[model samples]
Structures are given as structure tokens and as C-alpha cells.
Target: MFTLKTATSFEETIKKSLFICHATPITSAEEALAFFQTYHQADATHNCWAFKLTQSYRFNDDGEPGGTAGRPILQAIEGQELVNVAVLVIRYFGGIKLGTGGLVRAYGGTAAKCLHQAEKEKIIPTTLIRCTATFSEMAMVKSRLWQEGVQLISEDFTENGVCWILSIPDEQLDVLSAVYTNITRGRIFEKIET
Candidate 1:
């Protein structure tokens, strides 16, 4: 799965209706809701939205015809195999009405265009590693991990050294484990999980 590296937007007028779509990568449902609320156009005819998370998803027609607005937006997101994304399409009626089919096409097309133009990044699966190193080994071990793209989530100073909570990409787990073992001789390397 992939997600937008940065938020993006697209605007177009179709059949005299103005449609503005905002697409953003989100990490949580709360963030998605917040994005929708932040971009919702109170003065528009409708503010439809949809979001796809790793394990969950939701869409709102926002008073549009059932299955007309929101579902198409969600389909656009899924069709692109994107996760952790939220899309909001605001419509300002321009004194003309688009049929249900037109509405779906307009909203879905707008969202697709926005996402297509966005910069994307792959979602790397990661695992948490807990390791303890003596004071003397700490600097070297931490520097090597950083060089390998390991992210230090937290560090707790212990009596003898520092216990590190690291986020390591799954593809590099084996290599990192070997580095740790070789550096510390497997003395303080503790556990890796999740």
C-alpha cells in the first residue's frame, strides 16, 4: 500500500457545478475526521468525504443521493490501492443539477485526479526492537542504527547503560539484528517484536 507524501487538491467545474477535492494522507480515524472538518465547506451544497485506513474505512454522502457521492469517492481511493487516505469533495451548486451518474463521475474523477497528482510514498512495515547497551557501547550502537535508518522511538537511561526502543523496517530487521549482535557480542541485545 502507498499513501500521499503531501496533501493535494483538485478543482474543476462540471456541468455548471463546481467540485473541489482535497486529498490527504491520514494516520488515524481521528486525523481523517479532523481533516474533513477542517476542509468542509459550510457554504457549499454538499461536503462529501471518504477515508480508507489499514483496517477500517468510512464514507459520508452528506445529504447527496444514497450511494452517489461518497461511494464513488471511496471507490476512487480503493481503485488506486491506497490506504490511510482521506478525501473530501465539496460541491457548490451553480444553478444546474447533475444526475446521479454525473454526480458520481464528478466526485470520483475529482478525487482521482487529486490523488494522481500527489507525491506518494510506500508504507514500510516496521517492528519495534528493545535493546540494552552498556554506556560504552551506547554511542557506537546508536550511531550505527541511525545510519541504517533505524528510528529511535525512546530511550530510558538504565543503571549500566541505556535501553532503546527502536522502530526498524521489516526488510532490514535481519541485517540490523546482525549488526547489533556483532557490535555488542549479543550481550545486551534483548528482544524484537511487533
Candidate 2:
């Protein structure tokens, strides 16, 4: 799955109605709700939204026809194979009334355009590792791990050395373990279970 690199938005006037879509990368349902609340326009005719997560998804058409606004927006997100993302499409009635089909096209098209233009990155699987290094090996271990693209989540200094918590790409586990072993001469290296 992929997610937006950053929050992005698109605005266009379709059939005299203005549609504004804001897409944001989200980690949780709460974050999605917060984004919706923060971006919803009160004076606008409708503030439709949708969110896709790893475990769940939701959509709201606001006041538009049951499926015209929200479902199309969700489909747009899924069409892009996106997860952990939220999209909010705000509408300001432009004197002209667009039928159901027009509403769906405007909302979905705007969201799709916004997402297509935004930069995105892949989500790689990661493994958490906990290890300890001796005082003499601490600096070398940390530096080498960083060089290998390991995320050093935390480091707790202890009398003997430093306790390290690292986030390593799953594919690099074996290589990273070998590097850690070589640096610390087979010191304490353990996988942390979530």
C-alpha cells in the first residue's frame, strides 16, 4: 500500500459549482476524524469525506445523495491503492445545480487529481530489534547501523554500554544482524515483539 507523502489539495470549478479536495496521510481513525473536522467548511453546501486504513474504512456523503459524494471519493482512494489516508471534499454551491452524476464526477475526480499530483512513497515492512553494545563499541555500532539505513528508535545509556531499540527493514534483518554481530563481537541482540 502507498500513502501521500504530504497533505495535498485541489480545487476546480465544475458546471459552476466549486469543489475543493484535501488529501492527507493518516495513521489512525482519530487522526482522520481530526483532519475532517479541521478542514470541513461550515458555510459550504457539503463537506464529504472518506478514509481508508489497514483495518477499517469509512465515508460520509455529507448532504449529497447517499453515494454520490462519499463513495466515489473512497473509490478514488482505493483506485490509487492507498491506505492510511483521508480525503475531504468541500463543496460551495455555485448557483448551478449539478445532478447526481456530476456530483460524483466532481468529487471523485478532484480527489483523484489531488492524489495523483502528490508525491508518494511505499510502506516497507519493518522489524523492531533490541540490542546492547559495550561502551567501547557503542559509537561504532550506532554509526554503522545508521549507515545501513536502520532507524535507531531509542538509546538508553547504561553502565556497561547503551541499550538500543532499532527499526530495521524486514528484508535487511539478516544483514543488519551480521553487521551488529561483527561490530559488537556477537553481543546481546534480540528481536522485540510487538
Model 2, 80-102: lDDT tens digits are 99999999999999998889898
Clashing pairs in 2: none
Backbone clash pairs for candidate 1 read none
Instruction: Give the range where candidate 1 is weakest over 10 consecutive residues by summed lDDT.
Output: 185-194
Task: List the global CA lDDT of all models.
Answer: 0.89, 0.90
Candidate 1 on 1-194: residue-level lDDT in tens? 89888999999999888999999999999999999999988899999999999899999999999998999999999988899999999999988788899888998999899888889998887888788888998888887776556788998998999888888888888887888888898654455753
Per-model TM-score on C-alpha atoms: 0.84, 0.82
Model 1, runs deviating above 4 Å = 136-140, 178-194
